[model samples]
Each structure stands twice: as structure tokens, then as C-alpha cells.
Target: MTDISVFPNSLQKLVKAFEEPLPNLEAPPGMPRIKLNEVIGKVAYFYEKLRNSIEFQEEHLLRRNAIERILRRKILLENRNLVDARLLINELIRARYLPNDALPDAIVGVVQNYIDRYIALLDHLKLRRTSPDDRRLIRWLISVASADIEERLSPSVREDALVEVMYATIRNNLVLPESIPTGQEQDILVYLAIHRALIKSDDAILRYHLFRWAYPQWQTPDHAVTEQIKSHFQQLVEAIERRINHPLSERLLVICRQYTIPFLVLADVFKERPGEIRELLTSPEALNDASEKAMTKRIKSAGSRLRRTTVRSIIYIFITKMLLALAIELPYEVYVLRLSNFLPLYINAAFHPVLMAFIGMSAIVPGKKNTQLVVQAVQEIVNPSAPRMVFGKKLKPRPRSRFRVWLFNLAYLLTFVVTFGAIIRLLQYLEFNFVSILIFLFFLSVISFFGMRVRQVVKELTILTRRENLLLLLLTFVSLPILRVGQWFSKKIPKINLFIFILDFVIEAPFKIFVEVVEEWFSFLKEKREEIS
Candidate 1:
């Protein structure tokens, strides 16, 4: 074993986390277990898979989304009592969002208690029940509660511990301004950066983090604390809203992404021998061995993840395209255009998925130089003698002359016209009708945006910053306007997603009730057989 005396204090917390036994979750005796019928469970699982395919979300966020959906159905639509939390938990299990028989039955009580506390807090705030702010508050509360439930069901203690260690290490190494106008603490910014880069947290996850920060005792708040929070609830909301989109967040995210590979390498090295982490850090041969192994494993995993994500994206695009064809294209062609031609329809449906597959197949993985950079970065992070990394430089607004601004705007407008104009011209050449051309452009932009996003998997494994070649710059110039449009549509479509609304509101409620009834019938038949036996 290497001497612990030589190791820095920054790593002590991480060492302790790995050395300690993982916390176990046990079920309480005599609490009624919630079970679903096997046949119904299988059906529910299949239905959930189909529903989930409609909305592209990170795989990790699916469970939280499931929780939110179930809660909204039970509480908001069905008006179920918070005490009847077993029904909600049972549905989650039946859908296979949570595992079978793993969660404690008493978790129902925990969920119910959380709902009660949130309701109490809302009442204390005295906001008009039907007001927009109140509704927003309720939605936010539900999202936070759903996230909490997901965590309780499947805790990420090791991940959380790593985040804390990374935060501490980054903070210690980072040089920051003495004071900031943004009013965000440097430590909180560091925490947010780690969550975004390392944990890959989306806005919902970050919002939940902000909620925890705003009300630290939310899990177990007393009357006094509740009252105090009530007085500052509006202010707290505004603060969180501001911080969520703080100007400094993007720069911090870049910095955090820079360190992600190194932190991951360190985690992998320390995973097996928690007690010997200090020794592993000290030994150059061991560190190199571990780094090589980790880099190889990560590259392989990234390839697999890339393929999986690409397949999913293709499937999503194809399904959505077909749905849109049925909803909009077919109707417009038959009624408005009075056309029998379905060639454009066929091409529109197939194009985006084909393009996505092409993008996926063409993507490349990082090389030996990237791995070397990662190893060196990891060494730097662990070595106390390395110089501090400067961070938190204030972003100053650049002043541009009116002529320059106008000229840039004109160039951007021309680029947008040229990009769409070329595509429209091509579609026209192919005998694509006006409606078909519009649909093609719509999916083209959205799919291009998605394709670019999928390409980020390759970037994640790359440690060395890639230099932009002339070809790359040209391609980016052409694609940038389309990507911007895609980004806008991506944000807007979720709010008005017909598929989500239909599944959640139109079909899901009745479908779930039918499943529950079938389960009950199965239970009744089993009881009768037992009695006969």
C-alpha cells in the first residue's frame, strides 16, 4: 500500500465513500405489498415502451418521467387520495419503470408524506389556487417529487459521492473572481457544472437540484422552516429561474466537460480498491495501466451507446414522420391539392431515418492521442504540484459597429435563404408538391438537429480539442441555420405534442383502469381456486 500521508485532502471524502459499505434499503414488515398480475404487467410494459418512443428523452430520465405521468394520472385526473399511494406505485411496477419487489412497501408512505408536505407548503403560501403561478408551482412540485421518488427507488450514492469529490477538487483548483454581479456563489456554479457535464443532467434535473438548494429541509421541514420558506417563496422561485439560465453556466459546462474524462478514469481506477485509491494515485505504472484500460473500455462503450442512440433516433423519426404523414400530408394532398401522387410521401417518410443511419455509420471514435491526453489530464488532477486551472472569467459584452452588425445579420439571412432555397429547389425538381416540400424541410431541419446531437457521443470520448478544417467550417455554415430552426421546433413541439397528449389523456387513463380490473379478476380467480383446494 502506498503512504496516505502524501495524498492531498481533496481526495479524502471520495476515499471514505468507496471504503464505506453501500447503504441498503429494506422493506418494513406487515406493510401490504402492491403486486400486478403477470399478463397485465407484460401488456403494460409493452404499452409504456411504445409511448416512450414518441418522446425522445435521455434513458436515465425515463423513470422520472414515468413517475410524473403516473402521479398526474392518479392525483390530477382520478383525484386519488395521497394515502392511496400503493395504487400509483403498483402501476409504476406493472409498467416496468421500477423493478419488481425491490422497493419497500413503506415507500408509498414516504411518497404520500412528501405530497402532504408540499400541499401544506402551498397552502401556507396563500397563492390563488387557480392562478397561473399556483399551477406552475404545483407542476414544479410534482416534478421535484417525481425526481425524489425515482432516486428513492434507485439511489445513486456512488455517483453522488463522485460528484461531491469532483466539485471539491474543481473548486480547489479553480481560480475565480472575488465578487460577482450574478449573485451566484462560485461553489454552486461548480456543483451545477459537474451535474450538467458528468451526470448529464437536463433542465428538469437541474431544477430539482435548485429546489433542494432553495429548501434544504424540504424532505423534513418543520413548521418554523415552512413559515420562513413561505415568506420568501416567490423570491426563491425568481432566484432559481435566474440561476437556471445564468450566463456563466455555459462556460462552466465547457470547463467541466474538459475534466470529465479524467474524473471518469480516476473513478474506474478506484472502483475496485477503495482503500488503495491513494496508492493507485501514487503509482505511475498503475495509473497508466488503469487509464489505458479505462480509455479502451470507455471508447467501446461510447461506440455501443452511439449505435443504440442512432437506432432509437431513426425509429423515433420514422414513427413521427409516418404519423405526420397520416395527420397532415395525406389530408392536404387528397383534399386541398387534389393529387393522387404518393411518391413524395414515400420519400419523406424514408429520408430522415436513412440520413440518421448514415450519420451514425460515418461517426468516428477517439484515437491514441486522445487517450494520452486523458492520461496526462488525470495525472495533473491527482498531482498536488500542478498549477491551478483558472475558471470563472467574467464574460464581457463585445461592442460591434452598426454596419458590422447589419452586415452580419444580412449574411445570416442570406445563408438561411440559400440553405432552404437549395432544398426547396431540389424537392421541386423531384415533383414534390408545395405541401410535401414544406414537410420535407420541417423534418430535414429537425433530423439535422438530432443528427448533430447524436454526433456528440463521439465528442464525449475525445479529449483533444478538434481543429476546424475548411470543409468542416463550410458544412457548419450551411447547416447552422437549419440547426437553429430545428432547435426552435424541438423546444416548441414538446409543448404541443399530440402523441403525448393522446397517450396521457385520451388512452392511458382508461387503459390503466382496464389493466387494474383484469388484475383484480385474476386475483379473485386465484382466491376461489385456493378456497376450492
Candidate 2:
């Protein structure tokens, strides 16, 4: 305060100006002395206009474009695109374009048309590959559209929705390379940018407007173009899954997979009620908003599935525990035979019919055979891979299906042993005569396993006949039926057999619990591996 007299007159005026500083600015450090009051006022006015235009105001395409232009220029400048004073000229141009005084209301539509045409032009690039300048224009258009879209960014969406939006963004971005500015391709890219940023925002309503423009036609779809885009989409999903660094990344990968992974059994989804496929994929809340009755029915119908998911999940868990328990409970040979017996059955029943139906599906519906195929096809998926590529590859990993795997193991071992050994044991039990019951039991076991997998199970398991796998399977076949025969004797005998029956019960309970535990544990691991691969 005492130093005012020592300073030059111009410095004195600046000091005075600070006391009555420009309405929107204080003199910044290192700024040269200049009449920047008007400049500050204009800049503040422009920013106020920008904030109001895209998000706060009705989302007129023109106002959106204007705000985007401002953001683009600022972003460019912040990125150090200019090395000279021309940035000043660009700023002046911006100021002129978005002046403070309200423009006439009718002029808004004209500006909107310009904005619309600009956006449309950017969207037309994917099919019309062009030169560098054209690509630059496309990038510029996208940059602007992104600016418009992000004006509404907020934390209003559910974590799941956020995950989906991020996944959607990542999939699209995976295709875009850094040196992507090409002329004829500009429109296509700009279109992509608009939608990418649009969905990223948390606006409750604006998101739908953004999506309707980009989807089906603009954004690459898995369904329509199966070859190029499908593989690419799969790759994108895999890459995202691998590269996920955040918790939400998992959900993102899932959403990406959901879109890329075609429902191998969509007919099952449609079986409930005549409902739009979109309703299932989209929010049920949105569906409810459309019709309360529809919502109630939809929820009521899904209630069974929801309950089943919980119950099945619990059962799967139980089955898994039993499998683990068996590793310790049974002898090595018994384990082998039991596992082998079940695996073939598992593999056979797992994906047999559906795989067959998929292989031989004909548009012309065949005769009565169609029903058989449909029944089988329906069972297969409730019963296996990539609808698209994942990060340049399309390998689908089988999760540890403890239940299915154990079933296959059982099938591999039990079929022949139950059939052949039961007969030998029955001959001893029936006064040296092999009876029909033993033959029937043996035959029944064999037929059951055989019926489940005539083709796939046999094909895959034969290819996977590891020595350890075989050894454990062989043991189970010998042990399980002996246990069964012992139990039969215990049950048939008089009071003295009570101790033998108890012994048999002990053997069976441990075996059952062990199988169930292992089944669930393995399934959990398999699911984890599947997600990664």
C-alpha cells in the first residue's frame, strides 16, 4: 500500500485497476499490462453460454455444435496445437460466433440444421473411406460431438449401467487407431465419436437420443455382419477382460460379451411370454414404465428364473463339495472309475443335441424329427463359445464344470463295470445263477451313459484320455458296484446284516457328499477361467 508512489504511472493504473478489477478477472501473475477487461468479459460470457447450451439448455443441435466448437478450440489450445498468435484470432472468431446477447429465437433452428448436417456428415464416413484432410474433418466433427455429449456427465447411473457404458465405449475405441484421420472415412469416425461420448455421460434422457443414432447402422454390430465385426467384437471383449484394472471392468467385459455373444438358445428366452427381446436386454424398469401390467407379468415370469438361479447356484455349490470330498474319501481306482463314468455322460449330455442341431439346422423345418432336435437343442445350452473374436482371437475356455466333469468321469468308468461286474456278483448272490436283475442293472448303467453321449462325449474324451484320468476312472468302476452289491446283501439278510447295512450307508454318504462339493468348487474355477479366456 505504501509503494504506490514509487511505481510508474502505468503500473499505478494497473494497481488501481486491481482495486476495481475487470468484472470477470483479476490480473494474473506474469500477465503483461494491457486493456484485457473486455477480453475477460467476453470469455466469461462465452463459457456461460457453453455451459448453458449443450446440457443446461434444450439440446438443440446448433447450440450443441457451438459449445463443442468452443470446447474443441480450448482443448486444441490446451493441447498446444498453436505456436503463434493465431490462437487469439481463433478466440476472437469464437467470441463472435457465441456473442453474449441472445440471438433471435428463429435463428436457433438454422444453427441446429447446420449442427445436424455436420453430425450426419461425420456419421457417413465408415463406408466412404477417404484422404487425410477428410479424416481430420471427421475427427473434428467427432471432437465436437463428444463435447456435446460429455456436457451431461454425472454419477447418476447404476454401477452395472456404468460398466456397460464403459464396455460399449471400449469396444468401439478398440477399432479406432491413433492415426485415424482419413477424408472419406471422416463421417464414419465422427459418428462413432459422438455416440462413444454420448453414452459415457449420465444424462437420464439424452443417452437414448445418442444411441439411436449410432447403433445398428453406425456402430458395428455382431448380428448383421457376422464375419468381420463379430470376430473384432470378440477380440475387443477379450482385450477388455484382460486389461481391466478396475472393479467395474468386470461388468464392462460382461456387457461387451452380452452384445457380442449371441444367445445360442434364444428360443428359450422367448418361451416365457410374447415379449420384445429388447425388454430382456434393456432395463425391466424401463419396460415397467411402458406398462405396469407388463412389468408385473414380466417380473412374475422372471421370478421363477431368479429363484432357480439362486437354488441352482446353491445346488451347484453342493455338487461341487461332494466332488472334492471324493478325492479323499474314495480309493484312487474308485475315484478314477466314478469320474470316468460320469464324464462321458457329462460331455455327451452337455452339448450334444444343441451342437447337432446347430450343425444341421435347415431353414425348411423338417418332419417330426424337428421336435426331437428342438428338445435336444434346448437341453444343450442349459447344457458351450465365442460369437465373436476376443482381442484378435476366438478361443473359448471351458470353465471347470464340476458337475458335468464328474458326470463324465462317472460315465467313463461306471458303465461297463456296473453291467459286467453286477452280473458276476449276482451269480454269487443267486445261488450260482446270474439273474435278470444284475443283467438289467449292468445294461441299464451302460445304456444310460451311452444314451447321453453317442458322439460328442466319446469324441472329446477319447482325445483327452490321460493316464491319471484313466487310472482313477478304473478304480471307481470296481469299487462303486461292489459297494452296491454289498448293500444289496445287507438289505436282503436278517438281523445280523444291520451292521453291514450301516457300513454300506457310511460308504455311500461320504461318496455322495464328496462328489457334490468337488462339482461346485470346480464349476466356480471354470467360470473364472472362462471369463478370462
Using TM-score as the measure, the top candidate is 1
lDDT, candidate 2, 1-533, per-residue tens: 23445433432342343233223222345543222224444544465453332221223243344445343443232332222222222232334433323222333343344345334433433322245554454444444344333233212222223223323323333433334354424333333332223232222123323332333352323334334333353343333223223233333333333222111122223333224433432433432233333323433443443344334333433453345335432333244434332332332232333332322221121223322332332222211121222222222223446799799878856665665666557544543212223433433343233222222211211111134678777766654554454444433442344443343344323432343355457658778999999
Candidate 2 least-lDDT 10 residues:
456-465
Worst 10 residues of 1 by lDDT: 388-397
lDDT of 2 at 293: 32
Residue-by-residue lDDT tens digits, candidate 1, 82-153: 425677777878888766666676678876776677667766876553577776776666676777777777
TM-score (C-alpha) between model 2 and the true structure: 0.16
- Candidate 2's C-alpha runs over 4 A off are 1-268, 271-275, 284-419, 432-438, 441-443, 446-533
Roughly what TM-score does model 1 have, to 2 decimal places? 0.87
| Candidate number achieving the greatest lDDT relative to the actual structure | 1
How well does each candidate superpose onto the true structure, as a TM-score? 0.87, 0.16
Backbone collisions counted per model: 0, 68
lDDT of each: 0.77, 0.35
